[model samples]
Target: MFTHVDAIAGQLGRGLLLTLAMTALAFTGAVAVGLVVAVLRICPVAPLRAFGAGYVTVFRNIPLLVLLVLFVFGLPDLGLLYPLFATVSTAMALYWAAFVCEVVRSGVRAVPRGQAEAARALGLGFGQCLRHVILPQAVRPMVQPLGSIFIGCALSTSLAAAVGVAELTGQAEFLTLRYDQPLTSFALTTVVYVALTLTSGLVAGRVERKVAVVR
Candidate 1:
């Protein structure tokens, strides 16, 4: 067991790097899509609002794994071939975007109505009000929830293994199969996941406290 430590460490390092890459890609894409959808959902235009609502409803209802499979296996026949990691990242991002949209919309709605009215009275246009006044206030309260979303994304990287993405869980499974060390491999994976979750929680807690203080 001691002799295998170096090999295990190397495998874990690779897995961690892959997991981080996936998480960063997913979070960036999700944030972009979610912010746009959230703004559209609150827009005065009926069609845009309806479209945003429909998008959220549809994607939020689908299972992430199903979406992953569709992207990885189904898209090739349609000439939309994606690398395994890219496919997994795209699916996860799209799936997570629906939830992020709802979270951000709720944050936007939580902004006091008076703030928007005051901004308008001060000659701020809709975009200015949102960019300068409304969103700044809304985002503070949303930090904790957004942190949880980040943690969730980190955990969801495990699903990438199903699509042959070679993320943390994927590497762990491969190592276990190769070395016939299921117990050791799984134990290490569990520990790594726990550390990741705990780190997320700590960061979130600090942000939550800071927001409370600022408020």
Candidate 2:
């Protein structure tokens, strides 16, 4: 019984690494796409704002499983073949980007209106003001929210297992089936996930405290 744990340890270790890789890649992509979408949502141009809102609405409303299935199976038919890892990571990124965009937009809006006015009075262009003034202030409040988003993104990487990415969840399931010890297999998996999230939360809390605005 316990021997199965030892036997599957190496495979599970690899799966854990893959999960981390997927989380890092997907979260990075999410942040990049989210920043762009957030900017568009707040742009002076109406069309850009509409497009951004549409993007967030579409992605956030779709279930991750549905989106992953569609991309993994459907895209291949269109001659857009990608590696399983790439496809899963991209889908996860697109899905989480909407939430990230909202978090960023809220952070930006939290800055005082007078701040923008002051920047304008100082002859700063809109972009310059946003980059040099608004964003700096906005980032402080956003740290905790962004951290939560990162944790959520990390957890969502498990969904990639449905498409056979062989991440942590997939490996856990494999061990369960192979050993017929669901409790042992899943309990260990749960511990690993819990440890990961708890560690992330602690780091985020530390970072938040470090960057906290004194005001």
Candidate 3:
């Protein structure tokens, strides 16, 4: 039982490291993609707005696991050879971007119409109004939800295991196999996951409160 602890510990560390790296890459990509989609959804161009809506609908409706499998298995057939880590990270980012786009779109819609009108009255162009006036105010109220998104991305890292990326869940599974102690291995994994998620929520709450106070 305890004999496998050292091996489990090493594997867990590697898993955590991979999860962190994937989360970082996915978070950045999701935010960037979401921002673009959000902007497109609200843009004056009807075609672009429609395209954005279509993208969000399609991606959000598809299962993340399906997308991951496709990225891992299908992409290589299309001459896109991605390593396990890269494939997992990219798929997670794309999958999460849909949710982020919806979150940001809601945030954008929450802004008062008068704000945009005022910006226009002040001779601000469309881009300037969005950049300087609209998004800043709109984003404040979305801090908590966006924090939730971050936590979700962190949790979603576990799905990397399905694609052979060896994240926390994968490591735990391996340990269970090696030690023949499924209960102990899985219990530890569950505890660690809960801790990480709870920590993310707490940190997000702090940041949300700080922003609220400043406002």
Give the top-scoring candidate (TM-score).
2
Please write out the lDDT profile of model 2 over residues 9-36, one tens digit for every residue: 8878999999999999999999999999
What ranges in model 2 sit over 4 Å off?
none
Stretches of model 3 off by over 4 angstroms after superposition: 213-215
Whole-model lDDT values for every prediction: 0.87, 0.90, 0.86
Model 1, residue 18: what's the lDDT?
94
By TM-score: ranked, best first? 2, 3, 1
**What global local distance difference test value does model 2 have?**
0.90
lDDT of 1 by residue, 1-215 (tens): 67878987898889989998999999889988989999999888899999999999988998888888888889898999767888888888888898899889889888889999999999998789999988888877788788889888889989888878777898899888878989889888889988988998898888777765243
User: For every model shown, what is its TM-score relative to the native structure?
Assistant: 0.93, 0.97, 0.95
Relative to the true structure, candidate 3 reaches a TM of 0.95
lDDT of 3 by residue, 39-134 (tens): 899899999999999989988888888998888899999999978898888888887888888888788788889989999999998899999988
Deviation in angstroms for 96 in model 2?
Answer: 0.7
